[model samples]
Target: MAKSLQARKSELSDQEMQLKILSGGAFETGELPTFKAQLSKHKIQTLRPKTFSILQLNIGYMCNQVCSHCHVDAGPDRKEMMTRKTMEECLNVMKEFTIETVDLTGGAPEMHPDFEWFVEQIRLTGVSEIIVRSNLTIILANKKYHQLPGFFAKHSVHVISSLPFYKKNKTDSQRGKGVFDTSITAIKMLNKVGYGQANSNLKLDLVYNPSGAFLPSDQVALERDFKKALKTDFDIDFNQLFTITNLPISRFLDYLIASENYEEYMQSLVDAFNPTAAEDVMCTNTLSVSWEGKIFDCDFNQMLGLKSAVKNPHISQLNQNELMQRELQLSQHCYGCTAGAGSSCQGSIA
Candidate 1:
């Protein structure tokens, strides 16, 4: 049998592996502008948390399809999944804290055996909204997950799915063959459930990530293009289009190294660094919890094995007090969030 993704991940720290991948590049110390120094120059050396409104939980790394730019490298081959026990722990945190939003992500969060149960539990905790970072393809991967659209609507779950481009060829090139067609079908299904309707409380949003080494086009322009193209081509509508920069990590990192675009891409990110965006980076407000209950400042950090600044970085020891005051762990990949118009889980910061 093949080794599970988690089993392979456990063999070595992701951070160490990332260093090895960028070994021959211009990523040497003192070469690139340090994220902290940029913040300090802006006179906001330390980023503090505001109200803890969002709880971002990474359920696991098991998905229906593997995309080129997927930072998690999740696919059908991954067997690591969150147990009901860990989910129960997450529910406990939600019940204890006044967290208003719960963002569930994974290889494909819907693939988790206890996904529905966890969503139901968190909804009972009175979270105002739940965001599922769906890959789109999963909604139609099989009969088991086909009912996800209605299921999501029933619970008022906000769906934020990835549709790399409004065009089929570009999207399929980055995601997989026939992904664009399935994604359009999925969007139409979501629309049928009143997800993207103008007055519906059920919200459906699309996320756009650049398919190559370049930074994303202007978010406003890209959103306009996506809306026009998708509406014209598929008769589909969504609440909003979020443009996220592809962070330099995971499979994307490998692509950068292989194509010898590592230096140029990193330089572009650093050159386009916007300090304003850094102040409101999602990590400052959201706490990322891994499948096994480990905690990090953000999902990117989670993938890189950069733990939270809290002395006890686990869901069991979640300390809102310490977490609020601790400094975040940042690396070159953070430039992805600060480049140009600024990127975050939601969309552009400024």
Candidate 2:
């Protein structure tokens, strides 16, 4: 039997192994051009910040379900979580900067003991929008979480839940068994509180991640299909659908290697490279803060252990001017963001 990736951690740190895989193999052999090379070909010298509008905080890695394609490699057994100290530091940054949006994410961000407190604190910061990236089922995962929809509505939190596909078989295959049904139930609960309603201030959006090793189809088309199917089948409604590309990293990277799709996928991204998309990549305006308070250019880079190229790389030491001036850290995985219509937390850029 083959050893698990965790089993080889003693031989090489997980981050180190991922970095080696990204830097060597086809990349070193010149079968694929480095991300920097691709940018240079388009006369783009450096990827820099245009603004600091969104501050995405990944609060923890403890989750209920072990999805097949989780880039964070988050699961029930993982214990890494953000301490109140880190959360406080994050709040400080929000107070200091003109952050327009505060994005909260995790294995299940609600799993954190301080989750509610942190949300309340963020609301106090006067940030215009507060987004919680939830995995729908979590709202029904436990008796304690049953009132989450009400709580979210009370706070006017923007809920962005993941539903890989409208069909059960597809969603279950990628997420877990019974996830689609549970997610539907969770959506109903959210809807009961006025979320996803027409002209409702309470916003509830669905996120669609391609179930396979491929780029997502056009966002507008996918949104149309989702709205039609969901409304017809379950009488559900959502404000918008965000289609996010799964970058090669962590569990998804393992899948690409195990299924022998790494090379083909990389080539496809290269083939579909869009200069317009590259220019609008999310990293230019978003700053990703890891659970440990380490700052990164984006969440993908956070998982890859790529810190922002600023001198002050932690939340406590945040230097807004320096962070805005530093160039973005790049790697082969960046191609995932620049391919075709372009993928970001907000979905299709081009």
Best by TM-score: 2
Off by over 4 Å in 1: 1-13, 20-25
Across residues 1-350, which tens digit of lDDT does each residue of candidate 1 receive? 22333444632226677855443255556677666666777897677776678899999999887787778877788877888888888999998888888999998999998899888888899989999999888989889999999999989999999999999888998888999999999999999989889889889999999889999878888889988988898899998899999998887886777788989998899899898888788987899999999998889988888898888898888887887888888777888999988999998987
Off by over 4 Å in 2: 1-13
Report the lDDT of model 2 for residue 28.
98
C-alpha RMSD for every candidate: 2.5, 2.1
Error of 2 at 252 (Å): 0.6
